[model samples]
Target: VAVFTDVDCAYCRVLASHLGGYLADGIALQFIASPLSSRGTPTYMAAENVWCAVHPHKAFIKAYSGGVPAPAPRPCAVIVAHDSQVAHAMGLPGTPGLIGPHGAVLGGYLSPRDLLARLRMDAATEPSP
Candidate 1:
């Protein structure tokens, strides 16, 4: 599963903070930081700064969940551009959109229970001989 999310959304934070639980359950969860206009437009500037910082991913996760923003931007421009391009290609118009292995797009915030249920449904629909 690929999670499209913004750094500023609490729901997205919850999902990221709890990623280990999903992974422990044998679920492969990949994240696509789909920073929306509300956050991306300005907050992404902060993200860019963090991207330039020593530990981009850690700095991002920390600041994203209400921590202090990083002090400086990193030297890498490609990561920022590439992430934006991927988000645009996926038709991601908002944050917290989830894509399954079969290309199913699930939008908005979902409680862990609901997410598990939906994943189960998707699993059940898989082709098997």
Candidate 2:
């Protein structure tokens, strides 16, 4: 699944917290950075930092689990801006916008179990390989 997420969104944090649940159910998440804050803001910078981190997944987890510590404001050649543009183009309403394997969009927060159920339903309806 691909998730359009904002680092500072509370609901995004909740979804991130249950990532383990999704993983346990064999769901692999592809996180796309879509900062809610405008450019040059703290939130945007933090999102950039996460994209630039040596371990982006770990950085993202740290950011949502607690708070992202201030990192040196260095220029990042990351895809955060591109991700934001793509999310906007997709007409996503807000953070935690989930794109399922078959391109189904599930906007807003869903518990891990609900997500797994939805995915399973989708899989059941797919044409066999």
Candidate 3:
């Protein structure tokens, strides 16, 4: 699944906190940063920093879990801006939008168990190869 997430959104944090459960259910998450904080704000800066981090996934997990240590402003071009643009184009209502493996949009935050159930249902409905 691909999750359009924002670093500052509380529900996004909740989803991130249970990421392991999703993975345990064979749901691999591809996290795309959609910073709710407008450009030039500290929240946006943190998102940018996480994108530029040596270990971006770990940095993102840390940011949502508690806080990400501020890093020196680097010259790396972060993709969070583009991610936000894509989310807008997709007409996503909010952060933590989960796009299923078959491109079904499951908008909003869903508990890991619920999400796993949905994924299983979707898979079962798919035409067999």
Q: Pick the candidate with the highest lDDT.
A: 2
How much RMSD separates candidate 2 from the native structure? 1.9
RMSD of 1: 3.0
Which candidate, 1 or 2, has the higher lDDT? 2
- Ranked by lDDT, the better of candidates 2 and 3 is 2
lDDT of 3 by residue, 1-129 (tens): 899987889999999999889888888999887887788898888888888787787788789988874573564544878888888888888898889888889878999899988888888899988
**For model 2, what is the error of residue 86's alpha carbon versus the real structure, in angstroms, after optimal superposition?**
0.5
Model 2 misplaced regions, further than 4 Å: 70-74, 127-129
Model 1 lDDT vs. the true structure? 0.70
Candidate 1: regions farther than 4 A off:
38-41, 50-53, 71-73
Error of 1 at 94 (Å): 0.7
Query: TM-score of model 3 relative to the true fold?
Result: 0.89
| Candidate 2 structure quality by residue, lDDT tens digits, 28-91 | 9898899988889989988988888877777888899887745735667357888998889988
Q: Cα miss at 9, model 3 (Å)?
A: 0.8
Error of 3 at 80 (Å): 1.2
Give one clash count per candidate, in the order shown.
Answer: 3, 0, 0
Q: What's the distance in Å from true for residue 54, model 3?
A: 1.7
lDDT for model 2? 0.85
Can you give the lDDT of residue 96 in candidate 1? 74
Relative to the unseen true structure, what is the Cα RMSD of model 3?
Answer: 1.8
Model 1 lowest lDDT segment of ten: 31-40
